[model samples]
Target: MNDLQWYRLYSDSEPIVEKELLNKLLSNGALAKFALVRHNGEYKAMLYVNGKRINGPALPEPLTTPNGEVTHWMGNKPGVGLTTSEAEMIIQAVTDRIERAR
Candidate 1:
């Protein structure tokens, strides 16, 4: 799928950082960003957006109830986060979305 379509799919299903906070991060050009990654066969919502070897805070993971309710966990831990390619894709997708929305 294309970037926008892929973004819509992922955004709908996967857990991401809070929109407001993410927007702030992007606006500030923060090197670290937030993302959900699959690790050891389980999904991990990382605390920060990591590129290369840089590290940052850990945010709570996203959880969905059986009834489709969504909530965040209250913990932060370091883990292998998104790959460089994945981060680039996410950035491009977000940027494309913002531009299209304008």
Candidate 2:
């Protein structure tokens, strides 16, 4: 089963951990305002704004990796990514989570 737990987003120098807040941000303006960070092979959030860090709220876990990140991997397949339909489903799942939180 492909199970998606939750998404923790980063925006330039902002950290958005709440699904409701993400929707609020999107509702307030365009999607360009947020810059999401990718993890493993998925999108997560981390912010860097004008050389400053903004903590929007408390998240289930720290935004930074607790034990640091790996420098090398064998199956990364740099050029490979999800198919159009796969990506669309994930986006829809994320959107559903945000809507459910509202």
Query: Which structure among the candidates has the greatest TM-score?
Result: 1
lDDT of every predicted structure (CA atoms): 0.40, 0.30
For 21-71, candidate 1 gives per-residue lDDT tens digits of 231133245444445443233333344533432233233433343222323
> Could you tell me every candidate's TM-score relative to the true structure?
0.26, 0.25
lDDT (0-100) at residue 101 of candidate 1? 48
Error of 2 at 70 (Å): 25
Which parts of model 2 have CA positions greater than 4 angstroms off? 1-80
The collision pairs in model 1 are: 33-49, 47-58, 47-59
lDDT of 2: 0.30
lDDT of 2 by residue, 1-102 (tens): 223333322222333333321211222332311233333433343232332333332111222222233221111111112233433443455555546556
